[model samples]
Target: MQMGIVRRSVGALLAVIVLLGAVPVGAAEKSAPRHSAQAIGKAERAMQEITAQAARETATAEMQDTRISSVMLHWTPYPAAVRYAVRVLRGSVGAPMKTIATMEYVYTTGLHLPLMAYGAVDDLYWTVQPLGYDGTPLAAASEPCPVREAEADPAAPALTTEYAAMPYAPLYPVYSWVPLAGQKEHEVEVYRREVGHDRYVHTLRGGEYDVYDDTPFTVPGTYVYRVRGVTAAGMPISNWSAYGSFTVAERTPIAALGDSITHGGGAITVPPSYQLYDWESYCTVPVKNLGRSGDTTEAMLERFERDVLPFAPRVLIIMGGVNDYRVGIYGAETVRNLAALREKCRAHGITPIFLTATPIRPALMTARMTINTPPSDWWAHRDYVNNWVMQQEHSIDVATVLSDADGELEEGYTTDGLHPDLTGKKYIGQTVDSYLRTHFAYASAEAERRVRMLKNMEKTS
Candidate 1:
């Protein structure tokens, strides 16, 4: 039976060729007699049907093995390389997909590379998942597969901007912009202003990015920065992003503390007690202003035990004496008042930060009748007080000039001539805040307790 079946199949093939008139046509007729027109049409239709069935079967098999997804990389300046584990598709009938391999990766400046598992052809399905190198869990599902055709993976772009040098121990702010569709949970970048230069310094690649409260940038100078997203396909999205510029504060925190320009009038905020907003969007740390609109060093001394000392602040910023100058308190008396305040803070283990009085704007001082004290006298007394404060090395962290002998708010940072308006407040607050955040690592609860206890102690003192 098998021999007969094989012979029949061979015969069918031979018949198909002969029926198509492969031989030459009759000489006189100029054409050979083709198979009956009906027979030829029938055979042609049958062949088309068979070919269509085969194509459908092949398509079904291919479709069964195909799956879509993508991958993305976050670039940082940290020297360590990023690692990820891929959970591959697994199982024949009842099996489950599981992690099969891990990979090491590097980030280009603001660039993300998209990758594909080479083995996952149309014959097999795959899904790529991201995992921390050591399984510490940096991110999971950082990228997607079969990226959208119309829109490129938002992460495909590379970032570019001008260059600046980094400082010896620069602290950079980290940033990441992964959207909702990304598989990864968080991306981060660090940036800082360059010290002594008019530009920003940053590490090209950050090793690992944290999800919350990325580090604050401490580099100085003014410069621009740019960042972009990258998909895993290793395709570069050639687009430059906008730049964020910042100026490194010329005066250090100690300088700010001692500089009279940092002093504010009326209920000024104090340190160790941050007044962060409820939304946590802006600065809201408790600060003991101790800055009465017309208070002098003498007044501050009277209020120190009641107001300032109780906070038990790790750092104490003291800006006073303009009022003292107006009241004929200068030279020796001014020095004595400041010295007393210093002793009070130190007795409670607080580091006193002092600032020289900012210069009174000569033009504005004459224009605004609000000036009660002579600018010349105020300036002289300020000089004397600063000289005296500077002499106390242990009690004073810093005692420096805010402006020249003549007061002038640095270009855009000040709103008024004497008192710091909103902008000045923010600028001053940031400087003070930076110092406290760095030096005093104590928690809010502890800080608050210290403040409360100190205040109580003062009642008995």
Candidate 2:
């Protein structure tokens, strides 16, 4: 009996050893395969080679923000490859000059872990300096590099993550819409701002959703949220989606009052011209953008009774001070100018909604580089008037407030800091919409009338 038991135990041990030996040696040893060491090293080196090739191919694609230009590259997609077409202009395109370099990448789907193939390239890598046509060295071009490989399996167990996307508009609150279909077992986290703090406000399990929507968040400020999807295999994809920011603003009527930003500046249809008032169409109430380019706040104040009062607008939106601040008006004087305009609106039983001044931009910065500071202290003056405006909110019934303190200036927002470019004006319209949704009672017919008026004004404008 003893011999039989020992023999059975030995047989079991031998079976286990054979099973372990059958697995791939490299997989078990946690190391590279010996026979293919040379080949693997070559592949690793090829990554750097491709990066170097990319630099040479895209030499002319490099540029700077100083020239008031944009980088427009063509995206041509094939089965598994993409090519970039480049066009760079230092000055006039009077004659077709030889482009600096063109770049492209090739991808394959076959065997042996497909590689980043390349096309023809120019020697654009500046580390090995090359002289230009005139023997003058052109600016050295920066080089591209390869992304590193992960040490561990991305789908490994024990990792957990979350992601979220929220839309934020300064001075206006927003309600988000999130869909839950395939993400049944994942954990969802929502971060919201109250007063000025962002704390974890809501959490839902995988099987449950729809617990967050149209849910009011904090006042006006930047809020971030995240959600994490976890698979049964314990893999986590917690990448946070882009931040969706929407400001919280008091609702007010669409005030049609101003100049160039209103009248549409330039020739009948050029940027920085009168076309800026196209946003009146998006307003909740009728707005007659009686703005004229080169019009000052004082000038606007002078004509408020004649131009704005006749419309019987429930709310008067006013965005000026760019011209005032540009001409050296600061602090209290700015307040007085804005206050006088507000008073005129109040006298005519119209509510005044103030659009806070946007920040001074870098391009505009150079013109005043010698002034110690930009001519427009709109940043400071705006705060002063806003403080006063907040106080008067009770006295004159100013309902909505629109501001751009948080929105980053992209090409569309402002060509310069003071004026709203085409897209910037439209963004202002969105901001105004958010403000009206919050502070006013839209259910009222009076409110509906205001909406109709805004629609007509938008059509005419």
Listed per candidate, the RMSD to the true structure in angstroms reads: 21.1, 22.5
Candidate 1 accuracy as TM-score: 0.34
All models: lDDT?
A: 0.41, 0.41
Per-residue accuracy of model 1 over 1-461 as CA lDDT, tens digit each: 33444455456655665766564455314432554555567677755655565556556655543433343433332111123433333333245434444333322222232335434422222333332223354444433233222122343233221111111111122232322223332222334434454333433432122121223333233434554433454332333334533233321212112222332211111111112101011122334333334556676677665444433445566766655665466667978887887787778776776655444444544453455546456667767876776666532222232364334534232223444433445545665555555655463234445435544533443
Weakest 10 consecutive residues of candidate 1 by summed lDDT: 272-281
What's the lDDT for candidate 1?
Answer: 0.41
Q: In candidate 2, what are the lDDT values of residues 182-204, reduced to their tens digit?
A: 33345545565555576775654
Which portions of model 1 miss their true places by more than 4 Å? Answer: 1-286, 309-314, 326-328, 373-375, 393-416, 443-461
TM-scores of the candidates are 0.34, 0.36
Backbone collision tally, model 1 = 57
What residue runs in model 2 are displaced by over 4 Å at the alpha carbon? 1-254, 265-277, 365-373, 376-378, 394-412, 441-461
lDDT of 2 at 167: 13
lDDT of 1 at 119: 41
